[model samples]
Target chain A: MPQQKLESVEDLAAKAKALRRDVLLQVYKAQSGHPGGSLSWIDIGVALYYHEMAVFPEDPANPARDRFVLSKGHACPAQYALLADQGFFPKAWLETFRQYPTKLQGHAENHYTPGVEVTTGSLGQGLPQAVGIALGLKVQKAAQRVYCVIGDGESQEGVIWEAAMAAPHHKLDNLCVFHDLNGLQIDGDVKKVMNINPVPDKWRAFGWAVKEIDGHDFTQILEALAWARTVKGQPAMICARTVKGKGVSFMENQAGWHGVAPKTEDYEKALAELAD
Target chain B: MAGMETAGVGGKVGVVMDSLRDAYGDTLVELGNEGANIVVFDADLAGSTRTSKFAKAFPDRFFNMGAAEQGMVAAAAGASTTGVVPFVSTFAMFATGRAYEFVRQAVGVGHQNVKIVATHAGLTVGEDGGTHQCLEDLALMRMIPGMTVLSPADALETKQAIRAAYAHKGPVYVRLTRDKFPRIHAEDYRFQIGKAVMMRPGTDVLLVGCGLGTSICLAAADLLAAEGIEATVLHCPTIKLFDRETLLRLAKAHRAVVTCEEHQAHGGLGGVVAELLSEAHPMPLRRVGVQDQFGQSGKPEKLLEAYGVTPQAVAAAAKAAL
Candidate 1:
């Protein structure tokens, strides 16, 4: 299914808001999942799926189509929401988010779910796979680009840096990574737990074309992605400053909601706040 | 089997000694020449693992992920999703131990078509000592669901095993030794994944082995034969898709069984044979391996003898089992 092009920022923002609601609803119904990171990443996921990527949900395995990897795979509710919205699978499968025998696993599983390009749950695995995909495409001289979204907290994994160092070394300009810097992990603040501070500087020093942007803003997200495409001889890293719970007020900037399901009252309040 | 002029049982295992990693590298070059959509990844050990040969032949298809086994494995897993077969090589110590989680999550759980050819397994890594030797790789790789594990006995088997690993779908781990090994499996020998070859047929005892341990079993069988104790030597190159039917049949025929491997007696081929026999056909068995101890720096030959993984050890174990 071809995604309807949203040329206007209002249209893209509206789509992202709807996705946020879907993400919360999936989490509320399942009474599980990482809401904070999902909320933080939905806008970027929305921009990639709806605005930037050349994906056909009908031909999910199209070799020419661009690929996306949720390196911080716990934020899969956002990806599932976007994938379902884009008609990769029936929208109703969202209700079976973390349910047993459901394709929509608690973490993104490529084998089980359509449009999910890689299986990821254990942190620090997804990005290197993205690097691999990019490297393979480069080897084939394929034009298709690879995009990956990683969490700030997930950066603590040594493998993440290993990928960070490798992508630039291979000159994977076809690859782009968006760091979802929401400043919170499960325990508390990412800085307090394990600071991956100096994020953009690290990426730049590692030879990536680095950019910092407001992750929730459609204009900046789209512009940064376009900028990433123009980069050559190096991978692109966009350090996106975002709120932990982006659209919902009560959960915003709150670390406690990192992997918590919304109570019924919280769900009603979140839904009311997300109303058009 | 041509050129098998009076050697080990089945007229296989000639006197020529060759390196398993060299065979692996040559097979990779052969696959590349065959137009297989194959990519090779090595974690800064291309020179040691012999994947540098592939790197030289096909630079575009080769990636030297500098000293980063986890990233190399994950990248290989990622690359496999694009309908390209990626063969990742690293020392067994780093490949299966340091970057174990990556292998489990990216390759095993994802069920991606990535071949992990871990060279320099077991104490045969020699002078590197225990820190660089991995004796538990077989157990680690086999325990992962949907993983195919193989440990080829010699250079000839290593070449065929690499081909077999590529032909099969999903994740595969091929174990190789750093040291040179005697050539087993004759020129016409075909390697069927998950099957064991009966090197020597006997009725008194059953001898099971993989990798260098298989060579030791052959020698042990010769020793047993001289002692008027006939033993069946089953060279089990493929450990995961274990030839249980053959093992069970041989076990019923023999009075006792003994398993040998250049690894820990608790895991690897020894552990696998123990698990299989205890469940299907329980019998007196002896495991000749490292006996659950760390290896120290020594010559490969001395290490094998010191660890009690030699033909003498296997022969002794077989006698004890009897």
Candidate 2:
């Protein structure tokens, strides 16, 4: 049987809300995961993994399969939830988040996990690796694409721009960089700590086809990604405007949830809000 | 396998390039023909590091990562994650020193199968002087956990080393020199990662060497042989995976040992040998390498001679150790 393709924005929006709810429930159970960035990236992850990207659940290591790298690895709860939902692993394994000897480590490990394309936690480094994968795929004349999602806070790393400069120079149209412009990092708001505003312009200056979109809006993300797929001669960057801690009312735009999992009471309240 | 046989014979008859950097490019092209999985990466020194041949043969597999050594190493690590065995080439100084942190975390800690092929190591980089010549790369790379270190003696040895490195698992650093030297090893001489090659056997004194120093030690062995002073020459190529049994046997047979390398005496092959011998068998030892001082602009041979890294210096060090 053929896989059911995602058709409308409403279907994608409903899927994003369901995944966001799962993200909150998992983080609440783990009591030691990042809820904010995961919540903020729900729609984008859903659109990419469910709608836009072409992947095979049974043959995750298929040479022709598209690649996705989570450069900002702290937001792994969303990635884990999405992969689990996609049947990369058992959904029951999601209960063992951050547990000993589990394939799901605090950060993704490509060696152990099936779906993760690269193991990344260090900021600014994953983009180059993504570039390498895309370059390698191109060399093999494979039709697969590479997508790399990074944090706005992580844009401060010099290596990011170094990679960015090479992507367009090589004419890597198969590569797409998603800057999760969630405005907040560990210490405080990303703008106050170090301004990465003019984000799309920065990527544009580095030679990528730039697109800005409301991160939580499913229609905007789908359109941006579809347009990125059509672009040629250079890589594309989707500067996704997002709210840190997007789903729950109390956690929305809150910097404290950047790396913290909620308490039991906080988790229940967060789940209730996300469900509604 | 045909390329392997050619490389094996080529190194002995001097048909191969004189320098390891040159051989790196040639060998990469051969490896590319042998297998499609081998990819080459450079930090904008395609010609300097001599990987242009591979670039020409496999343009799509070749990535000139600009002047960003750190990003190159990290990306190489990432490529390795995808199951493509990537050989990242750059100057020894930049590949190890400038990108130490990234190599450490991404390759070493991540346990990626990325080969860091570095050229222009030690004083042999000549008039480019201290800035380009990396005398401390071995020390720095050997310190990293799970890093396999190889310093080949000549161009032939470099080909053998590259083949062996590909077969080996995990991260590897293959150190190459910029200057040309004599081909000492004969054809069919197999190179292994952990085992040291016993070049010449003697009982009185053991001369331990690596890289260009290995060839110098072999020459010194002939010099000492002419003088009726029996000397043993051991080519300790893989510094990280030093042969403990061979070293112990050499130490037991020869009362004193003389260590040679084109690097700082501190934390190099000498330091590694000293630490091993000091713990197991206390033997009188003398080191022949660059002292704790910077190199000056001069010819490569003059620099080696001035730094007391000559055949005569090895003979003198052997006498002194005795």
Top candidate by DockQ: 1
Task: Score chain A of each prediction against the true chain A by TM-score and list the results.
Answer: 0.99, 0.96
TM-score of chain B of 1: 0.95
Backbone clashes for every candidate come to: 0, 0
- Per-candidate iRMS values, in order, are 0.8, 1.9
Regions of model 1 farther than 4 Å from truth: B1-14
Interface RMSD of 1: 0.8
Listed for each candidate, the true contacts retained, as a fraction, are 0.79, 0.48
Write one digit per residue (lDDT tens) for candidate 2, span A1-276. Answer: 122357788887777788887787667767787888888887888889879887777778777678998888778888988888888888887878787767877776676677887767777768888887887777667788999898888888888888888889889999988889989988998889998778887888888999999988888988898899999999999999999888789988889988888888887786777674
lDDT of 1 by residue, B212-283 (tens): 778788888998899999989999999898888988888899889999888889878888888999998899
Give lDDT: candidate 1, residue B142. Answer: 87
- In the predicted model 1, the residue pairs found to clash are none
Find the candidate with the highest TM-score and give its number.
Answer: 1
